[model samples]
Target: MPNFNNLQYASEPGSPTSPSEDWAQATADLIVVLDGATARTETGCSHGISWYAEHLGKSLLLAAADTTLSLVGVAKSAISRVACLHPECDLTHPGTPSAGIAMLRPDGRYFVLGDVAIVAESTDGIAVIVDERVSQTGVAERAEVDHYLIGTPEKAAALLPMKRAELAARNIPGGYWIAAADPAAADHALVGHLGLDDGAPVAVLTDGAARAEVFGLLDWAGLLDLAVAAGPLELIQRVRAAENSDPLGAKWPRNKASDDATMVTASVAS
Candidate 1:
């Protein structure tokens, strides 16, 4: 069985009331990391983004525990299960809470939905898989959100319109898929299996944890090395420090100064 080494995680809300919408679950044989979508518009459900994300994450953990179901099958079922919890709300509402997901199965297969990052290391090298469809689909909206940079009054003013557009794009044609009420979105997830010889040193990350490489702070190899040497929480702190150095995103523009960061790493047994 693979073991989680340097098993650590850190999650800070983008804002105090926002609630950290990221979650993770791990067993000797399974690992999952999820980043819940922030509500761009008002959701009819009083429970809000945090509520939906928690239910969805818990449901996913339960469904994936089955082990026998195909990954996609379980993922879709989980979406449907979460949706059933709120029959009173407009499930099709663009502001509905959702999440990006990454899962590692005992069979050496890994799956991804939305922009979650999954990296596996072996003698060959490092392989990172991310689904960019979400980012791509909301390009214009993202630009609008980024226009004034996070933390700026102007950006705050534009947030509602920008997020409305962002929310509108979900699950539509040319829009990206996510773990929302619609399970069919699971069909677009990224999936792959590791080779038997693909050794240990696997790292699964939320986008925040991946900023080191994504922002050119470290290469993939260095990321794996750092996780082993410093522990996963340290890696997140490093990101926090980096973001603090440019809180308004002057040097490195971004949607927010810091996002909820989370990671889980596992090493192959010898």
Candidate 2:
């Protein structure tokens, strides 16, 4: 049977005072990571982003344990399960709690939605999978926000229009899909199987942990090497250090100086 060994996992919140909107969990046959979308405007749900991520992550893990279900089916079941948890909320609201998802099954099947990523090494080569549709949506608004330092009033003001645009573009035919109230979003996930070599490296990351690649600090192979040598937490620390070096958006411009980061690393075995 396929299994994972030498697993290393870590998570850190963007702000020390706030609960992390990212969540990760690993079972004998599955690895799941979720990055909750921060609600810049009002979300119709009272349970909030963190709650949505945790419930979705847990539900996905449970559903994936069945092994017989396809990854898309797992995602559909999980989203539907979470939606049932808050029947009183306005699930139809555009800003309803949602998250990016990345999941790996023991047989080398991988599923990705939104910005979360899955990087795996196999006999064929290295494969990195992530959905970049959201990044393509808010170009002008995102550029404006990146001009100012994170946490500044200017940046906050700029984020409002960007977030509004994002909500407007979300889950439409031309827009991106995420784990939310609608189970149909699961059908939009990127899915495939990798012939992962025995003892090959694998990493699943939320976008925050993946910012290193976005910033050109490290390539996917290098990041996996770091995780193997130092540990997964070191990857988070490296990202934090990089973010600290560019606090004012002078070097690397972005909407936030820091974001909730989560990573899971392991070696494939059978």
Candidate 3:
């Protein structure tokens, strides 16, 4: 059997007033992860990330509890419910809701979506299971801008027409799971495994922590490795130190430079 443990945290790096990002977990020899979409409207009264995140997290738990539907089914149902409740959410087209999810199941099956990563830890090293939508690949890219920004039924229809087609164009890397981007709601990719008989630690993290450069720093993998070797408190301090080292004049390219970062690390007992 696999033993599981998780840690959750939230931070408001950019705006002092709006703390929209949400995180949640459910353990049953498996784990589910989600990142709600940041709201597009500036004055929509809490219409952005937090609303979707809270709904997605609760919906995921409901799906896990329901026996009739598969994980994917539960997620789709949840998206529908969310859409109904928040009529303002433009889910019809290629709009990507808050992204990424990984379900670790007892049957050894794992399903993942988008950029949220699933990495297997072993004596050799750590390897990522989810690949970011953007990379070195030079393939043509399409954006469903309307889908993401739509507010009306006619606008959503017009904007979303190319959503399925756009999603079809992207190429997924090997060993990485992908969920087709949905303009109005969340996207989910399913994966399964027989259980980590290998006896290594497992990690699922949001892109903020996993991104190679955050606030102008590189070698995030190196930092994660050190954190794994050291204790959690040491890891936190190390991150703090790195963030502090940035000179004021130096510009950080990240949109959410001081983003809300979260990670869940688990290992099978000896």
For 128-206, candidate 3 gives per-residue lDDT tens digits of 5664543322222223222232234544453333334334333333322232223222232544453455445565656
lDDT per residue for candidate 2 within 1-270, as digits (tens), equals 889988899999988999999999987688999999989998989999999999999999888878789999999999999999999999999899999999997679989989999988876888898899999888899888888887799998999999999988898899899989999998988999988877888999998999879888899999888987788899999999999888877788888779899999999888
- Residues 1-270, candidate 1: write the lDDT tens digits: 444443545565656666787888777667788888777567766677667767877887888778688789889988999888888888766667788989886456888998888877754567778888877755666677777766788887777776776677787777778888889988888887874242477788888888887777888788877876677787887888898898988777787788888888767653
TM-score order, best first, reads 2, 1, 3
Model with the higher TM-score, candidate 1 or 2? 2
In model 3, where do residues sit more than 4 Å from their true spots? 1-16, 40-46, 67-69, 88-90, 93-97, 106-108, 122-125, 134-195, 212-237, 247-252
Q: What value does the lDDT take at residue 64 in candidate 1?
A: 75
TM-score of each: 0.91, 0.98, 0.63
Note the Cα lDDT for every prediction shown: 0.77, 0.90, 0.49
What is the Cα-based TM-score of model 2? 0.98
Question: Which of the two, 1 or 3, has more TM-score?
Answer: 1
Model 3, C-alpha of 219: deviation from truth (Å): 6.2
